[model samples]
Target: MTGWLDVHAHYLTDRYTQACTAAGHHHPDGMPALPAWNPQDALAFMDAAGIAASVLSVSSPGVHFGDDSLGADRAARDLARHVNDFGADLVTSHRSRFGLAASLPLPDIQGALRELDHAYGDLRADAIALKTNYHGRYLSDPAFSPVLTALDAHAAVVTLHPTSPPGWQRTALDRPRPMIEFLFDTTRCVIDLALSGTLARYPRVRWIVPHAGAVLPTLAHRVAFVCDLTGTPADLPTALGNLHYDLAGTPLPVALETLLKLAPPNRLLYGSDYPFTPAPAALQLATALRQSPHLQDATLDLTPDSPGATLFPRLFAQQGRPEDRASPA
Candidate 1:
């Protein structure tokens, strides 16, 4: 229980500020833009929430947008390194209180590959945060193969963060729907990836879909029906079988229900989507985990690690052995 971890949090850095400033955007509370965040503040929040540490990354629309021009693409690379370097420093200085998900210049695939070399090879990121749609392209598109290939080669943890669909403009009156739309978008992108055989093609890459796995848990049967109806390959179950989901921004019952239908409790992980969603969600998630009858059967067959505790064996070392952690899902 002391090993509580928040898998979703965005810790802003100079590059994050520059990207936001460049886009003429401000922080949610209208707080003056920041060059970087204090990890100590994050530790304090973790203390308040009874969480021990958080896995950090840049939020949506990561530096790729800033790479608007050819010259900007180069700047994007530099900025990405800067942001990840800051992440490295944060974790190193804070000891075991934090982990990092490196940022990428996504749509710029070549740039992304280059950055991955450093982030994965050198920095050893716990995971990499990716948006379903970046700039104008869905991540399922073929052009992203190189990026996925690298991830597969490394067995990298790919944490999918939700971002609004391209051209989604919010009006003052309908503020919250954008978040809902983003969840749907995450679901859609995952479906697209599965339908396109991307998931089957890249078996080694570990995908951690956030937002309580978006809409997949509830809409899985419908998705299968339509895919089957349209003469689409019905390999979704295989794709979903190996995938993992972090319960961020999803209600406890909703998330648990989805887990029961679309996948197993073993693939489930706790994610708070912190700063955006607060500590209450984390407590709620824990409560749901303990109370959910759905997990009873799943938790029964403890291979080596408890089914639910295997993903981050490093963080949950007390619960299981490394071999159990490394066991195939």
Candidate 2:
């Protein structure tokens, strides 16, 4: 009933639908218009579930398509603004109950930089959301350094969500993408970043990898060995330590153990990947977290000082209740 924050979610807008159609991409099964996916619906769900805040973000398959870098960049940038403005309006209406994560045009450094400036200066987004891989190239690639560089300059808090690689959807496996591929994508991204020294280069950037860091925790020993073989022992712990993991869509025992072994307690935050994954699941996970014997004495309580205290402690105190705030973040 308290310390609840749903940080991962998707809302479809006209700009996003149009971009999908323009790029010859078929809209997914659940894709719909803005009104159909409004924050009001999320608020209603949160209220019913006893959630205090929900940090919303545009969903995956973010703008990049097969070699359509320029077109994807333009679409992504425009859609980022549209989403941010819409989120700003929602925050104005709902205040602390809702915040936004900005979408970026990845693999296109300049476009990403421009979007970052606009999203921060104008839209006042709480953080940024990025897919693990854009079209097959992982963000850990050196080619994407400029994107990280721009994010570091802005001191952005980024949440890494995952989507299947292009052409892999509806495969013969007959499995929901989230059940199998999303976790793999997240783990792969973490490994790529570790191998590429991304964590070292952009040390200050705060990242939250969803699904409790996917498979990274379970496979850390092997990953560490690989790093050692490659003569980068320092990167193993650095990557494991520097990143945050969101407790969205991951089982409690798995998430709790992963947090315990791979990251600090404070780096483990609450997140419910809503809509696609229901809010009740998060409640169940939180209950399990509270009951975990593996957790230390420090992490037993996840509640904020006030309803909105965890994410925006100072702002909530200064501005009074969350509904009274003017800015989106």
Candidate 3:
């Protein structure tokens, strides 16, 4: 099997995690604990899982912790800068094995915009990572228009990852949000993007939806029907055709089968959601995906070239084949 290019991998720097912990995210989004991560460990996982390269992003709880006090914006801005800088350095160190999808400090619009410019301009990120919602401000909110506009201007690859819902306390049922709420949040934000005409407004920006489209495959018709009845701008089927989906989580015969209903084979990309997923579980997922009989029929192209290169040609080369050289000191 060819080495897989994973688009949905995650990274957690010590300072970034420390900030989250200080802000009371001891177990972010109600996970077991903040998983340990480092460049060498990440490369080891890639080698073991047959991943040629991965686009890394700082996952849930994002950069801002919703502190409305004085100097909150400055704090958020500093943390976001730190995260992007750290990610940029990671890319510099392992140009072949990893790419940074710089995280923004959203709900703090000015700060986010600053990071966006730095991310695309200086850091030269492979993509921009945004949570489905920021401090209850969904991507479709008018407040996010500036961010979207800037991203469109750059024709950036924007990855939509899920975070805790505003009502997570009531909705999560005391279980980890990643277990279920994450998928729902992904679906909710995507439907919002379509219905609110967000996708239409940002045609130049390409979006990568994680977790096998996160219930989108199954809800495509239902969403489109509602939009038609309500006279909303949502054309879910058409949008699905345009956007990309990553095989991050348990996208086996079920999710994969349904996802094909809306997207073509080439639009599908591999993702490992690692560290957050725990290496052992991630390995099982990667192994299972490769061995799926149905996937064999799809002729899935897991190579380094095709689709990803078209989006992130700057960082998609097979630079870390041996893995040892790519490992950080």
Candidate 4:
């Protein structure tokens, strides 16, 4: 049980892959083609990387795949249901090794509400996964108030993943969106949520921001200054401090150092981002975390009583591995 608990892994069902293919979104957000995914392969990768368990979710370009209004919403609803059902099955089959962050069809409030109820009530999802922006609408927009209200009422855990920002394709940048724009979009969404008062209004919904808050460390002071100048009631620093972060891609000296400055050690969680991040890369990062001098004195907490444990207590409770359950605080 000497392994990490990965909070940011991804799972792609066969039907989900097909839906992406049909929508011409195989290389979603202009990244490389979707990687092959199977439960056995995922479990093997986790074992090889010393990952005790992984909380999975659908990744970028999510369920809303079409351009036509009616068609896209309908497709998103169906795909969300399919993906959730598949994820629920995985959780049931591999209770100790897997957890789920149910997907919702955003920008379609009614559809999202329906799926939320089904995911929380029927599937018993551990958390919810939301893109930084739904279509062209940011999460702070009033359009998502209903969804936010529901999640707030339940005191749910929400993980924010980056999507291709609007007009990203026209940027003329040679690199893929994930390389640069994904981080920017993630930053944008955080700022938007803070400025629009979503964080204040929905205090009970625990948030997990991936990729080490996606450049938030570098921009924290600047954002705080802007908030001051704008007369915004929200304090960017406080808002950011309250959220949990996942060490997904590369949690080395730079990323790790920056994150420590903004968040306490308990607020940090390990994330593999597997399938999207190949096993070798994920293993390398995990090894790096273990060897990092900065973490030498700190015990990596990944238990039900850890700082963000309330997000998915059931998943952590199923962690029968003694070492995992005994993770240092």
Candidate 5:
């Protein structure tokens, strides 16, 4: 076995950052600055951290900037295409060490659908990376139903990443968005998915909740209570139970324990959150995951049989062949 398989690694390009900057997002998601990234640096970090392969996605503040004259929606779609192509080209170069989880510009139903086709069909991406919200709208919004429906049709592997929630400024208290808002926003989106019945509706869309289910394990019961109080009942537990979670951030005791209570151990996958997580911190998280007493099972090694690997078996096969990474339909 080479090492652990990481399903939540992130990558950035100078051009992407420049574009985001042009759109007035010099400090994306309230982070001080965007981390530098390239395949060589990522490979170095992965080798040091004992990661055999990493499924890469662009981090928060995804592809969209703000609405612009080029038409914010149109620009977003264009950028998503470019990002996916870049990722595909990267994977083509390093088929064994990396996998691409392509991006999509949502809330623009048609644009999203088009990009989804290109990402999965043309680029041959391994999975889909999505933000929790776009322009104050969340995955639970009815407007997203069409895109969600298409994902189910493909049985897509979807990773839900958190972004600054709409109006996060009021409650963020000037703290970094990743410090707290990221975790909370993920929970909020999961709750909305449950509340709006999106989770149940999109049964085939396998969801990979990041940061060890991020505040979701704690809120499972709270969501049911909220639904009960509002006289709008939803089977939140069943919905949450069906999803997969990546152990990205700090999943030592609290997050992992709570997550295990709601999700099965077999549904867990390893995540590094690199670049954004910094090499040292990411390595620390990786070591913690390896030594975690809670995950001493057979799947902990991140082999093909592991839950996360099951989502992208091609990447974890005994001799994974990236030659045909994503065969377009």
Candidate 6:
């Protein structure tokens, strides 16, 4: 694990920033202004952190930046394409060091489907990054079933990122949404999928749950009990075990222990939530992960050559493009 394969790094393009700024989405989900990001700065941080490769996706406040149905949907679609194209170019320039998890303009199934085709068929994205909720609609809603079906057809790897829940954004108790709301929203999305039978319906879609499964691990048994009482056939523990959890911002000992109880070592992946997390903080978490006593013999696959590679074969397989082994920055 000399060089990490970060599954949770973010890439912010200039076009994306402009879109957010113009839409007055500066404090998205109640977080402060968007963190600055540039290829050189990201590459420099990766070098210092010993990250050989990173799978990039857009951060919070995704593409849909406003409430206008017609206008915002169109803007979101365009922004999604721009972000994907920008990420694809980064992967092209640094084939071995960069991979893309294409963003989708959710709450708009047709537009998302179009982007999905372009991302996989045209740009060759490694995975799809989906927000927990879209305009107050959770991913498990029937409206998103079409997109889930399409993803299932491709057997796509989908990464779940948290966004402010519809009505809770303004009521975060004056604290940053990521501090508490993000974790709660992640749990909400997972529970919705489980209760609504979405997870059981689409088993092929490999889900990557960030922030160590984000409070879901702690509530797995309770959810299972409730499901049993309600006669829902969803198996909470098994559903969680089927998915991957990244050790990103929440890399504490308790978080690791709880997540491991649900997902095995093979299902664990490395993540550095860079830019959102400063370089020093990201490095601190990485060091803590390496030194964890529970993970002493866990075979944490942070590098490209690990069981984690099987999680996204289209991107990690050594068959297509020539590997770009050049120094980053």
lDDT of 5 by residue, 1-329 (tens): 37777889998877898888887778987888888898889999999998878899988899977653358888888888888998888877777777899998776778889999998888889999999998889898887888999999999999889999989989799988999999999999988887777887888999999999999888898888888899988778778888888899889867898898888888888888999889999988777777788887527455656775678876766334534345322
Error of 2 at 276 (Å): 1.4
Candidate 6 per-residue lDDT over residues 1-329, each given as its tens digit:
23667889998978888888887878866777888998788888888887767889998889987664888889889999999998988887788777899999988788999999999999999999999998888988888889999999999988889988777747688788899999999999988887788988998899999999999988998989887888875578887887888889876868989888888877888889998888899988888887888676454444355645787664556434566655433
lDDT of 5: 0.84
lDDT values, one for every candidate: 0.69, 0.67, 0.84, 0.84, 0.84, 0.84
Residue 263 of model 6, lDDT score? 84
Instruction: Give each model's clash number.
Output: 0, 0, 0, 0, 1, 0
Candidate 3 minimal-lDDT segment of 10 residues: 320-329
After superposition, the stretches of candidate 1 with alpha carbons farther than 4 Å from their true spots are 27-37, 170-178, 279-309, 313-329
lDDT of 3 by residue, 1-329 (tens): 24777889999888998998998999989987898999889999998998877899989988888665548778889988998888888877777778889988888888889899999889889999999988777999998899999999999898889999988899899999999999999999998898788898999999999999998888889988887888774668988778988998888858988888788877878889998888999999888988876565443334454677677676545443443334332
Q: Given candidate 4, what's the lDDT at residue 148? A: 97
Work out the TM-score per prediction.
Answer: 0.83, 0.82, 0.93, 0.93, 0.93, 0.92
Local error of candidate 4 at residue 324 (angstroms): 18
lDDT: worst 10-residue window of model 5: 320-329
lDDT of 2: 0.67
Model 1 residue 268 lDDT? 66
Tens digits of per-residue lDDT, candidate 2, 1-329, equal: 34355666566667666776676655442234222465667777776655666778876766554365566567666766676677667767766577778887776777778888877898777788888888878888788888888788877778888877545655516555666778787888888787777877887677888887788878877878876788877547556866767777764645667556777666666666776565566557656665677644333222544223444442343333537545444
Clashes by residue pair, model 2: none
Give the alpha carbon lDDT tens digit for every residue of 1-329 in model 4: 43577889999988888989898987777777999999889999999888877899999989987654888899899999989998888887787788899999888899999999999999999999999997788998887999999999989999889988988867627568888898989999988888778898999998999998888988988888876788864567777988898988766768888888887777888888999998888888888888888765444444546653456677667776432322211
Clashing pairs in 5: 124-326
Task: Give me the runs in candidate 2 sitting further than 4 Å from their true place.
Answer: 14-36, 166-174, 279-322, 325-329
Off by over 4 Å in 4: 230-234, 297-301, 321-329
